[model samples]
Target: MAPSSQSSLAAKPLSEFSFPSPEVTASPYPFYEAMRAEAPVYKYPDRNDYLLARREDILFVFQHPEIFSNLTYLADPAQAGRVLASKPPGSVLLTNSVLSQSDPPEHAVKRRALRGLINPRYIHSCEQSLRRIANELIDGFIHRGEVELRSEFADKLAVLTICELAGFPPEDRDIFLSWHRIGTGHGARFLTPEQRALQGKDGPEQQAYIEKTIAARVKEPRDDFITEVIQDQIARDGELNLPYLTGTLRQILTAGNETTSRLLTTVMKLLIEHPDQLAKVVANRDLVPGAIDEALRFEAPTQWTSRLVMADTEIGGVQIPKGAFVFMLYGSANRDETWTDPDRFDIERPAVRELNMAFGGGIHRCLGSPIALAEGRLGLEIMLDRLKNPRFAPGCEDERENIDNFQKRVPKALHILFDAQ
Candidate 1:
């Protein structure tokens, strides 16, 4: 939890490695070369699983169900209790939800149900809305010349877009924001026992708040996704219980906000850091989608997602035994040479070769990816439109990996001086 990985390799055992190094997790690219070279399937004396750093290996674990498993691992009572105890247990859906915590039949069922609400075509239709939100946020901050990228732009855009899609009132933004903060806080290395203990309040608080709100929506339904799930199709099967409905909502609220926030933040930070790249996109807004892909490749938001090995498996000469945990170190994979230049953030990067393991692969791939891309594209376009002379703050260069391997920091905070039109 010291967070810096600058010298972690030297401290790590010959066979083991560390993640989210205070420095690396804060800003990881510098340390990735070392991670890729010294340890790909990194063993950590402190953690329960071996971390996969190489792109090929991480993608392999992500796509190969026979070798890696997310269902059992996410539901491990011990893991659940640990993460859950980290905060309050209000919703129970955080642990019991099918999208993030369950596997196979149950995961498939919830995934399909969630998918039904926002089909790929439906997600595409929301592009205009996303663009509108992006423009609104960037418009406010562009003239300020300097803005706190996280709180002002990324945070607001992600939260507002997802909330609108989910049909939550903007007036209740604080409530949903609180829930997301607590859910992500689970296992955050920066927190001490006391701070983590304080976080426990998030559980019960979120459950109560969501249940009440969603219940109201159920009775007096509207045109939102929440209404759709509760009144219309949620009861299609008698087994579609409250927990299931709430669980899907939890997944949407959390996944939708967190990942897209990171994506937008990184895109802004990257554009500022790489002014030339920003210029390319300005010349061709059509490059916005490709820019988003490159940004995801450069610094993916949801860092490492691990799977528990239900059965023994082999990869790259290593034999993973049953019950072992396989961590897909996406941050490391994004920079792995086995894939591409790995370091450069190029908007024109090849499409098929796009480093996609960021959204996950196979059955568990993020159901909301279509929206994530749309949001990122919209957000960056708006930010770029107003950035007259964007540059990193003096001495404020992105210092290390990120706040955590889970959430990334772009330029950390962007300080740009925009000229008046």
Candidate 2:
């Protein structure tokens, strides 16, 4: 995973701008800055889709769900058909049952039913368990004086926490990781054909596993999140449809784990890279929460989310016709000019409520946001407190690899050295 040569996107015109190029995926800020400054409503050449870079346009699109619809699963009927064909007949993937992909009455109903799972008290109640998991992870590698934080710490912490909440068996963690990698990886346009073909196999396998879990949960309910969803669905709809249940569970497992894991990796990488900021958080534990928030703004995990333009509309004075895909570049909006010193990572930065599009905006905002923040804050606090003088392992920074995807940006490995405790 050698670093790709940097592209001079600042000098390039907006019409030529293409997302997901290898150089942009590695580091996208320059291109985003150029887009925001020159063409806030630039149309991508390849897809004829719109890419909104400014905070105002991105937020406007997110807030105006009526104009910009989330029913994007149906945007490409042929592609959707192909995806559904690979799954079992009754699979929920056949239809979009996930929170982020639904609209209006259906979205409201599903969100309400799933709301109890991520309620404030519920997320707070998991603190002790989260802390215990964090310490256990640290304990495993504390004696080594060096460890790869991505796989060894962040990945395990995020997946285990979500799995514990979802009532997934600990033994099946690797299987879920594979499902996440393949499901997320293959969808990226940047991957080579060979890579995409290899990664494509995981989707059907994951769907099969989800189907089996739903069937098992139907017969016997447990104290896990999946069981709660099942009971809620039964109570709401009078009967359990395995397809619907599978859709909800798939979103929870993948979204719940992947976002938090990437956040952990980003926060840790930012903190370690900026030792001055890291020192401040180490001195005052209260700053950890702010640091997590700032890190999310600095490097949003889910970079861009798309919405289908239901009808002809004008956004940022640009006339966008119907049948166009509007890409809300969260990473770009997070660093928009509205925030002072947008590029600088500052834990002390004033709270910019509703401005940061990292968790998205409006009704479709991430439901697991509270849980992800709690996990990140707690994980960082425990690690910073336990690991003495942690820094990148010598020469490891050059060897670091980023998950090559335009939608999500995260390090594949973050090797760090610290004093053995």
Candidate 3:
């Protein structure tokens, strides 16, 4: 037979399992293991939603956006309003900038506008600047012999990179990063007490800063991505579509920074856990990208996404009503039986890169994935080059539970003592 259908913890029973439960957030693999077998199309007892626990089922949902719409992300007012309420009024535009939120013709237009700017080729062209930014952050504590790797270096690398690519003034990077923490709903639990206090304070300033930048680009275009994008948008619309541009820029900056940081942190953490694998990658840099991709598959940062059911649908033998929410568990699907060793953290896994839902799949896939991967790979390469024999500090080897949320796995603090050279 295949692996046992019952997880050792299955005694708790599937009905009692509350997702986003602090318990499940801390140790999700076992729970996922049972759900895939026992309840592949599990229904939420508390809400009118369904969670697709199996890989094939989730991929089916991803592929059929006609029946399972991305419109739930922002197009549906009830859902969008619920989400928009949490965000600052300054971020109204941030609600619907990503093309992934829509399907078909409009998605194509949005893709054309922003795809070229954030694509892998464009991101690679900025590698020199990225390298300089990585070295600059490392230079801050490389001589100190120890560093809190996640916050000190990883987060800043992601932030500075987004600032570089978006043409934001480098000095305002702190402002944007601060505002971003509050903007991404999954990020609130990861913030410091000080960061929590600064939440509402930075939104207005960040809004004003973006507005100022937009005006500058409109009046006199500069030799930058933002400027070129603004020129194209104005030509297409005849007048500035302020909300659209604002949302697109914020989405690009938000997703790029947040996802890349989490992925980079996870990549580093996995390497620490498997020294043999880490040695392989460190000795051979070609394995860097594969290592990052494997980390994404092993532990996806953003976990589940809720999609609106456009029409009544049946998935994995379970019937879901139209307009109900279907939560596609990217984390669970990634760990399902699709891989030979479903739970193993193997960087050299052949089927992972093309198939993993770490960045989601099909048309609604993450737009900034190329940038996130590039950043993670380059960020890891930079760290391994500088921080020799990096290992966790005693008693601090494990970080806190994943930010008290089911939606994303954010490793906010991970301190390590490194032989910094």
Candidate 4:
């Protein structure tokens, strides 16, 4: 039988709950259980947003985008204004051209343009390059016998692969990675004023870099995704301009690398902590794909995303007025009691059903999911083959650090030790 609702946690009032608190952000499962049972549609105090924790509510929100709009630029104009203020003058940093923040018609067009670049066939063909990149990353640290996987291997591999695919110069990989970190950190709610200010400077730097890259690609197109985007613009009589192209490129470069790096770190951490699963994966390389899926389900990278209510609606017996924001907790929904042993990190779980909401659903589902999965599977396969008897470095098994952000759940560091092969 399914476990009873956590009645003990139902006593706490919603006003007392904080979404981005350090305690909750570090380990939100307990809070999620409480919210799922006590208040599926929870309103944040002093805010116009609601938190939807139950799986059913989240699914409903995903399916009914007409009611819950993804046009975040329109939904939150103040925030968009602030973001635009950080960019160059006349920049459309928060414009609908960005696939993630756009709505229908505009979203459809932008999604189609990007789909042609990152389609499944393109991702599949990049597997050999991904594997080569993964091996090269491992080669850097194999002789050291101990390495911090996050910075040494995972981060570099993710950024390098994205740079190669985006037609960026190889030497600019670290610069792009730094921009991603700064951009992500700047947007985080839990960051300090100093940190935010430091990160804020990178916004225009990233824009300037992308702008220059787009200009160069337009004049000298190459056999890369950026070239494809440029050709599409020419074919459409220049319907897509520099700002729109840069906005799309920004999303691709950051999201493509950030989420995949987090996945690589999390999956490796899970395997090291669960030796039984690790042994199975090491013995049989074919298990890596299943293991990746299970890891995504167990610890999603992008934890929560919000939608704007286009009309007054009731969800989970609670009335949400029009214009209220609904935050779908993907991390919580993935661990809902609906799944068999939902909390267990079992690689052998049946793959017949949709195991998790990691990549989201509906039309706005992640565009780079195929590439992320391929990169993750190939990275792990190479690691398992090259790293002999890998395990966490001494006293480092419990030193995992997750960024204190409501939207993203990424490990900051993961140290591991293995025999040099």
Candidate 5:
């Protein structure tokens, strides 16, 4: 994230740029800015893929799922099979059933099966629990006066909030955290089989536990998403698809935490860097929602998402071949010309009719967005309420690092200090 990173990128040819250049993860905004202007539909040099940076181009791809597929695995089964062949059994079992990875008819059925996730009544009902979870997380760190907000607060709060929604036990937090770490960290593809085996060692126990929960729900229904999905699937398909549930649960357990946790962490970092904005939010708690939106725009948590080009097509005048993976740079698109001074982190920015594409768009737009927003708003509000005059912990500016992911912007550490009551 040094100043030279920007200059280095400026000096390079658009063709010379790599998909995941060394400095992209550390200082992505500058890279995103350049890509948006120069290489809006960049063909990544490393592979048969494209990086879509402009808001217009990304929106076009989002709107046309038929032309550009979300089911990357099905679209290119050869690649999918090769990758899954190396992945751990747990991942191999769960990757395909991911709802966002599919299109129409299939996507519709799965989406409808899990509609309770976005049900207004369910969200409204969970507000109290979400608030309570946020406060409980604050309670753990408020008395300490100094705490690592990433682990103690943001990550824990996100997991617990998802736990509340999924009807997963709060006691299983360590499990969720560990799984998320392995899933999002270096990834299973890079790890050796021995390493992957070590990581997925608990697969049987985890599966058994989930099966037990599903059986319990089958007998005595609950209000949680797991129960909602189970009943709806049975009603639609006349039988339960354990593989479907397994994949959905895997997505819920990991994807649910990654984006939201990173959002909470990044938002906290942004506010601390701009205390004036933090003070404004502190004064007008109503601005909490706006702050979350601005954070989504300014520093999107999930930075890159990929869609398969279903057929040869032109986006921003660039020809993308069939089966080419188009990487939608959400970070870049969110900062596209759509906003005046898109780089500035302004909570006061006028609310736009088309908000940023941080959670994606179309039918495949993030289903967990309502929960993530609610969790973020309530968590930040509680932090402001409980931790007065929060600021960064001293002497760790260079030590803080983002997760080793091009797609996610989560930091490994977010140390902060606050005045205790």
Candidate 6:
């Protein structure tokens, strides 16, 4: 938590580049500008190692896993030292899931089990279920004509969808949300000092819950994702132990449920803001899929991901020492001019497929991409169909003005006045 020790180097000072401060966390673009202009790969005078801000450099870190390891913050001696030296064994953010912790072979084995159930075919196969879930949530609040969009719609829709896939009961949505909120830090590092103290608090209780669930599934397995993972060859191989199973379930719930919920809220808000974009999509429903991509590009749900260096690496003309930490700024990467217009929100932007780093590319790319896409498309399509006349509410405690953060972008509570279809 001290200033950069390598101040005498040839690099310019990134002292002015503010990090997770209240203002920066609320709206980070201004700080991102300062950092990108000063040093695309900045070594803050008062922070950790190089923080990649420019698109190309951020992509380089995300794409190259050999030099920059995914499990760095959790595995690196310095970071791990700090984490262990603290009250808890882990950091505010986690790297214990198969996607976050393992490299190559182990990652492949665990991901293969998940990928089999989350493949494109399976995603399409679940379309009817997705549509039903979407409508079910919408139906609950449609007659009311007024609802808290985040809690009632986006959050509920995503949690229910993920629960159904993970074989958790619909009534346990609140519990799933509780676990995910604790795990992902909710919107950002908004956890107070006291909250941060509880990072790894309930280890045994959570482990026991997952064990019981896995045991119940083992006794009489259902045709759901939990049974699939529990009975998986990798699970039988002893790779999915108590900690691993608990972590993986947490990952699926948080990564899939939270990100998709935020992203759905983002796109809905975007469409309402840019009525032209919404009109275009309404006129040509085919554009819903492309609009989902555009929404993802415009406002990525995940803003930051960290990687630790395994060997000395050079990226974007900056040399990072072996054991240095690299913060991959996905939000900045999405706006890279080398890929698209950078700022234009064009739903029909040709599918050049510029490799949006929103999902964390390369080996660490989300195994739930298909599920995210499905949820996004289905969720958006349902809103489009149900709410014929949608616009922002006159005044209902707007969280919009203060949401340009590293974690959750867009207003947490989006009050939209929609005409019933």
What does each candidate score in C-alpha RMSD? 5.9, 5.0, 4.7, 3.8, 5.3, 7.0
Candidate 5 lDDT by residue in tens digits, 21-72: 4476676776666676577788766578788888788889878989887766
- lDDT tens digits by residue: candidate 4, 201-276: 7889989999999888877778888889867855654344676678788888888887888899999999988999
Model 5 clash tally? 0
Regarding lDDT, does 1 or 6 come out ahead?
Answer: 6
Q: Go through the candidates in order and give each one's C-alpha lDDT.
A: 0.65, 0.78, 0.75, 0.77, 0.75, 0.70
Candidate order by TM-score, decreasing, is: 2, 4, 3, 5, 6, 1
Candidate 5 residue-wise lDDT at 22:
47
Per-residue lDDT of model 2, residues 337-379, tens digit only? 6777677888888874346689888888888888888899899
Question: Which residue window of length 10 is worst by lDDT in model 3?
Answer: 86-95
Scored against the true structure, residue 133 in model 6 reaches a CA lDDT of 86
Scored by TM-score, the top model is: 2
Across 176-275, the per-residue lDDT of candidate 6 in tens digits comes to 6665243342222344555455545655555666778877887898988887876674445544344556667766766778778888988988887788
- Which 10-residue span in candidate 4 carries the lowest summed lDDT? 87-96
Candidate 1, 315-386: lDDT as tens digits: 677777787777676766666654545566788877523456678777887788877877777777777677
Best-matching candidate per lDDT:
2
Candidate 1: residue 97 lDDT (0-100): 47
Better of 2 and 5 by lDDT: 2
TM-score attained by model 5: 0.87
Q: Is candidate 2 or candidate 6 better by TM-score?
A: 2
lDDT accuracy of residue 197 in candidate 6: 51
In the predicted model 6, the residue pairs found to clash are 3-46
* Alpha-carbon runs more than 4 Å astray in model 2: 1-18, 79-96, 180-195
Superior candidate under TM-score, 1 versus 2? 2
Residue runs of model 3 more than 4 Å from their true location after superposition: 1-12, 73-98, 180-205, 397-400
- Span of ten consecutive residues with least summed lDDT in model 6: 1-10
The residue-level lDDT of candidate 2 at 15 comes to 52
